[model samples]
Target chain A: MASTDTFTDIRGCPSGARPLHRPRRRVPREPPASSFPTRSGDFGTGARTRTGTGARLRNPAERARRQWAVSGWAGLSVVCRPGVGGMAQSRGMTSIKATSGGESAVRVRGLVKHYGSTKALDGVDLDVRQGTVLGVLGPNGAGKTTLVRVLSTLVQPDAGTAMVAGYDVLTQPRQLRRVIGLTGQYASVDEKLSGRENLYMIGRLLDLSRKDARRRAEEMLERFSLTEAAKRPAAQYSGGMRRRLDLAASMVGHPAVLYLDEPTTGLDPRTRNEVWREVRRMVGDGSTVLLTTQYMEEAEQLADELTVVDRGRVIAEGRVDELKARIGGRTLRIRPTDGHRPAEMAEALAASPVTGVGGATADVEDGTVTVPIVDDDQLTAVVRLLAERGFGIAEIGTSLPSLDEVFLAVTGQKASVPQDPRPAADNSDDLEGAAV
Target chain B: MSTATITPPAAVRGARSEGRIGLRANLRHISALVRRNALQIKQDPESMFDALLMPIIFTLLFVYVFGGAISGKGHQAAYVNYVVPGLMAMMGMNIAQAVGTGINDDFKKGVMDRFRTMPIARSSVLIAKIVVEIGRMLVATAILLGMGFALGMTVHTDVLHLLAAVVLSLVFGASLMWIFILLGLTMKTAQSVQGVAMLVLMPLQFGSSIFAPTTTMPGWLQSFTDVNPLSNLADASRALVNGGAVAHSVWMTLAWAIGITAVTAPLAVMRFRKKA
Candidate 1:
């Protein structure tokens, strides 16, 4: 059974918290970010010292330290650094690692596969630790399905190698099949047979006797809440029910390693959440899973590590926030309250790293200026410098970097396939400008 | 319902999950598959209709409508005796091809993929399907024989010869199944399998001596009947059930059985494995 605490923690943020910045660079009397989950602010030492209400007025960083300490999995480290221009950027890289160790559940290196003239997989590498979820994210026709097929031993790679549950995929596929369970994007349950019969058949195929297979089938039906529908043919079941049955079929063997290919592709949001909960429960029980999906939010919510693939190759891989932070950091927008010269606003930002470098553009229009900041301290330095210049700040809010932006930052463009050669080159130049 | 989660039974957990479980286990797996497919046919009204109704309908229509015209007046019993064995062989071939069509449909539907990913023997699927088809053939043939008995057409040969005829026809039909299996793996859909089966198997049935003796056919058609395996199966059946020279036809049919398996079996299995 899955603990409710993991689901509550998984709701952290689609994009994580904004790293608060204090320009003075003072280490507080006590260290922050060593405890429990915090909601008020980043684990900034004495950053939110004022302006908050009574309860929030207490040390927000101290609360964060307590929450993280109790969680025992997520490592929330706050590192503030000053750049070459003497502008401080306070950044928090929050990485969620699973609580299991030792041998990897899945490991692949330089796998190459080809079909006629089409290269479905070309030199792809992945590592999924024991008892963790590794989300493989890619768009349609991006070789995500092909990679899953190769790793699951359904299709042999033309080159390189893969190891699933300590068995070589190419030479020991039968052994690999014994330890691993695979649920394809399409449900593979028998349509004419009742759901109970379908599960019973799979159980028997996996070498269970008649009585044991029947017993296991009943357990699975009840666990998935399909007890009443167990006797009905799978053809009559809804899409979600069929998917649950397919997933249930894979679990009947008690597989140590499981593979799910776009598991919730056609499900509604509610059904998709239920599937997510089941996956979390499986992970909580110490089973390793490698899931391929196109949903960015699903990856953010469930995956401890993510591998973003595009065009048969891995483009980016890391924890969610690390990947987000790798792309130009969050966007910081400031609308000045007092009207000022465009030159003065640009001059004030010029002293820091946001002087139109690293994809940050400062637009001075009608006494207001907006600049993109790739670092937390850049925001702090800009805030301090603007106050020093006697420029009243009207509105200031930081936009957290999303997966779409991270995808764009790494791949340089979206998943569209273009045919124009000259225009593609021109678009690539603009892509470099847009990507930090 | 208090957390009765899935647990691998001790009987299975103690052994290697994908180990070869011996001939008994393979037979058990194959029987499970055959039983499931048998259930599928039992539940499907279309399959039930084809199994029980079509044989009786075809028997009566041919023995009554074509009987008088082909055998002349007062010779209907002789025609019935001849047509019974011929229709039995034809029905076996027809049903075997339909099994191939089912295999093709399952391929398109991802059923084959589901079986392939499991930790069981790969041949269990094709083997189980063949068993179900042979079972259907036996049931259909038995009904046809019973209808013949009702029509006052008794077998001239003894029980030993009649048994040989039934077994020989079954072997020949199983051999022809290899061809449709190859075609099923090659074709795209069940409809295409039917189209190709008609184009290929129907000509072999009609152009041969299934309806009338090949000795009375055109010179060119006689050449095809001489070589057609359907002609061999029909001739072997007529000799055993109707009492005639059986040695030459039996050898020729056995040769066709070996020749078809030698050619088509490898091609079908190669295609299945190459897809992996």
Candidate 2:
């Protein structure tokens, strides 16, 4: 049965085929006063299964375990729920209370930021709960990093209200700083200091007693697997090690809210997984993480609820799976036997309930015909229909929607590796010792 | 979990004392920074060698080589006496670059950013750097005086003149430091700070009377050198060391220090805030 609850673009744009690709360029109206808060809230509002690469539907048992994990933590309140289904027309602030009664980790109302004449955040209102990870997924120039910087108190917004851990960003920034940690795209660790000393220095600044600071430093050193090299200066460490140390340093304060801006922009797959594990560990310990990344796989694997921002405005947001489901549940694929047989394969596949007739002969050169299947059962019916029509089918496959597809569909843009050029080192030593 | 929830008088006192924690925290940070840099220097004494050795070498070179040529006919004026004071002032100015380089190194290493994100006193980082520089300038001064005495550069004045000359030179050194500190903060690249400092210091020193009397220069150059801060500092220092009249140059030296401080301090603070 087709659910009429399916959201269609009000302007009659086709769903699941053509994505709402036009860039949102206008400034949004002001959010309502009720939505403003002095700071952000806690995390862990909800959870579900962690999908593995194996071709299996979500198991009932896994869902129950996830539900348990989400609820067992002490409850923290969510300030606002993301507007569902349709595009947000008004800039009105929406007050949302989390499942837990605790204060929100972040509260923002009509937070608009601009760079010169170009607007980076066109009046965005976001309420991230405490102890949970909120993954910010966006195409290039989506203002994800800008929003993170503003909330982290590194950059000031041109207009609107924001609070982190209950401290006003503008008025009570110093107090707010005590309760948060920020990691930038590049590692912000001091390469000259030993890994242990870096953590200890941060701990000392956070008002930890000497004994407590040393203890915390030791704990972090072991946690990030740097204990063996903790005494060695960070300059000798590898790129991944430095990145890990940067994240570990931010955790020295045990900040209530952590802002990670593209934490893994340049890392090998193995290192990326290690970082993902570390993030999970942090969330499990009840720390709220707000991370921005260009890697869709990272977002799909880690985000509890993802927000897709484009050109400074939120275009879509939902649980990762739900978002994928909205943009066509599955894709059916097939291959033809010969390089020139695309027309023959398209004819046979089109007869078997496929929606579109599109492909080059080279796509079918491997003897394949691909189709988008709504249900797995359709695969069996398609194969039988192909056989009945005396069409030779060499290969067929079905796959779920990917983050890249969702990104392309929603923003009408393909995902590319993010460009973040590190500045070149210059020679000269007069005051050279002054720069770090 | 609470039994009658009563507040203690001691708790109130503790809360009151907490207000001063910010100051204490900053002091702690300053001490930590100084200790860290000092330890680095202790482990590698070669870094401090330049400060101690460079002044002595330059003083000798100036007194013997250029001193006689500028003193001219040498009938009355002692060239060694004339060169000592100017060399002492020049030594202080040269050592001031050490302060800028120290701060610049910390900034380039991401140490300053780490400090910024911390809850430590905001101004303590720069203050610690200045403290380190003052200590370095003292060492340089000692080397310079030792070399000058060996070269027959005698001071005709008493202890007060020696003390005042050293103090004035240190003040002038600090004034130069303020200008460079501003440079270090404004120029993001360490190389840029080095380039700009060399560009300013070399010309200023060359144009001053550290190596020769400004009266010996050409018409336009003489007037420019006469008003130069370096010349004023050298002349005042020479008067103090030789027991000569403490003329208007003394006030001029003090005025230059005060003037530069007044203008550069605010600009430095602004740049520091912007970068932070």
Candidate 3:
């Protein structure tokens, strides 16, 4: 369970300060960020500060300092003094430092975003420790994209606050922008520009010198294995190549925090694995990544933490194994060849808690009986009972709890794509007429 | 790894020099947009052919067909002098749809969304679109002006006057970009921009004194035409080409141009930010 203190802190109303004589003050706790149940291995290691309101009122710089101190992961010291003259130099950025020293790369408190009347993000709070991958798993329209947008500075939040890379998102957006890279779901490259030109354009946008932009563009083309096709216009590029180029273009400035919003939505397994390898490479180089995915196996494979969001709120969060363990029971499958009786097969599977009793002769194409046992120990009993019934078994296996089942269990909706308001034609004639 | 411990002086200096490079990046983005527009022109020359060809065709057809009735000049005579300036002003106004339609297409195609995530300057995308508009305007000007010259339209003004006229036309052309940018943000469809912008611009061209002198129009229409920026622009262009006195209308035309740009630029930018 999430801490009561974290929830109260997010409310900004001190729990103990409520007046007994006054009317009831209704304060809604901010929704926790989409993430899995975090292990308590390091929670109390950090301090949460409360700066004085007077200090916040004096100077904007002091206010940023207060927010930073209040919000930043505890062990690191971040000082903000007035005067633009020495501010950049005083940050001590002589050499690039890894963000892994007991500091959260991202922190949000009571962040809320509303699109008209629809609350896209219903007050999201998050803490991402440095250099780890936090995968946001949610069905479509679960506010994953909205959360990423706010943290990335693409969208403004209605309420609450967030800090990225020790910079307050609202107060220090320009600085925050420099330290983060965002790759949205759609390809953003200019179709008229060549792949090389597209990367070069982004490099230029990130403030690289002309020579450096060219150099970076060349490097990215090679890194994404797009060097051969670099001179061709992006309009002619394949879907997978375009996605690779899009990801490559986002890396022009070597941002510290990378946000990949449903990065592999339209990719094939091989191409998806290629993107996964690049993400792994980035994380290996000490870049903190926030990825939103609908793929369960993807979260299990790459994420250090998983957060499941449903209907704009986080329903469950934790490491993948912890989520799997919480599913409580595993289903065991039994395949018996030429079963003596269907009753014997049903009885074997019904020995444990008996949550369900199901078997089908057609479950095995070759005239055999199959049953599902929902307990680990029940599997042995099934084997013994089958032998006692003088029935030979063909094969048996256990199916572990899957993320699909978890999603259905939590959201009460089968994981499927929501119907978009706009419908595009099939374009069968165009597809057939296009050059391969 | 090779055991070379030496660091080049360039490398050492480069590491220490922390100069601001955002301006250069923005300049590069603008140049890239120009190149991209050039490539688009290359791929679909027919699409841009209309911007250049339409103005010339309109000059030829309108001058030959309507110049005799409107200005009492025969088609074979000096009708080119009467219609060329109008054609030039109309060319700028005609290409306003290209900016709005192109921007609307880009918005619909998710191009703007893509640009938002890019490390480039946020203003550069719109700036690039405006730069492309300037090119289209110049192309249209060249085509119409060349057609007029080919048809024995003599310039009584000196080279300086001609240059000033061209510069004024281009300034007016650039100012026209803000309205299109704002329209592009307001309208969801590229085709709707064509339908709506034409409805607004066609009257501004025909209802004004572009085709004929304001003296030829009715009294109520003449007053409206006098205040029309298009009329002032056409009058200014005519005075420059005819080597007449630098008219008071040039100042009014410039004022309108500056005023529209001032009001619309901020609104366009704000709308763009909201859309993104």
DockQ of predictions, in order shown: 0.29, 0.14, 0.18
For lDDT, the strongest prediction is 1
Model 2 per-residue lDDT at A139? 65
lDDT, model 2, position B184: 84
B16: Cα error in model 2, Å: 9.8
**Cα lDDT for residue A208, model 2?**
61
lDDT of residue A104 for candidate 1 = 65
The runs of at least 3 residues in candidate 1 whose Cα sits more than 4 Å from the true structure, single-residue gaps closed, are A1-102, A331-400, A415-436, B1-14, B17-21
Give the whole-model CA lDDT for all candidates, comma-separated: 0.68, 0.63, 0.64
What digit string (tens of lDDT, one per residue) describes model 3 on residues A400-428? 35566655544545533221111102212
Estimate, for each residue in B1-276, the C-alpha lDDT of model 1 and write its tens digit. Answer: 212344543335447655565677788879878877987875575885666776799889888898988999778888989898998888888888887788787777666776777766777777888888888888888888888888877889888998898888888888888888888888888889899899987788898778888888888889989898778888999999988899988999999999998998888877765564
Interface RMSD of each: 6.4, 8.8, 9.4
Model 3 per-residue lDDT at B161: 82
Worst 10 residues of 3 chain A by lDDT: A86-95
Q: Which stretches of candidate 2 lie over 4 Å from their true place?
A: A1-102, A139-141, A330-400, A414-436, B1-21, B36-53, B72-81, B98-109, B158-163, B218-223, B245-252
Residue-by-residue lDDT tens digits, candidate 2, A1-436 = 0000011111111112211121221111122222211111111111111231122323233233323332322232211111121222211112122222334578777789888887788777666655445678886688897888787666788899998867788876666666677787532776666888778777666666677778888888888899999988787888788888988998887667888888778888788777866776665455677878887777765565466777777665554554555554445555444343756766666654533433212243334444554455665666677677776654444444667766665554542322112101111121122121
Query: What are the per-residue Cα lDDT tens digits for candidate 1 across A291-324?
Result: 8888876776677667877777776665554455
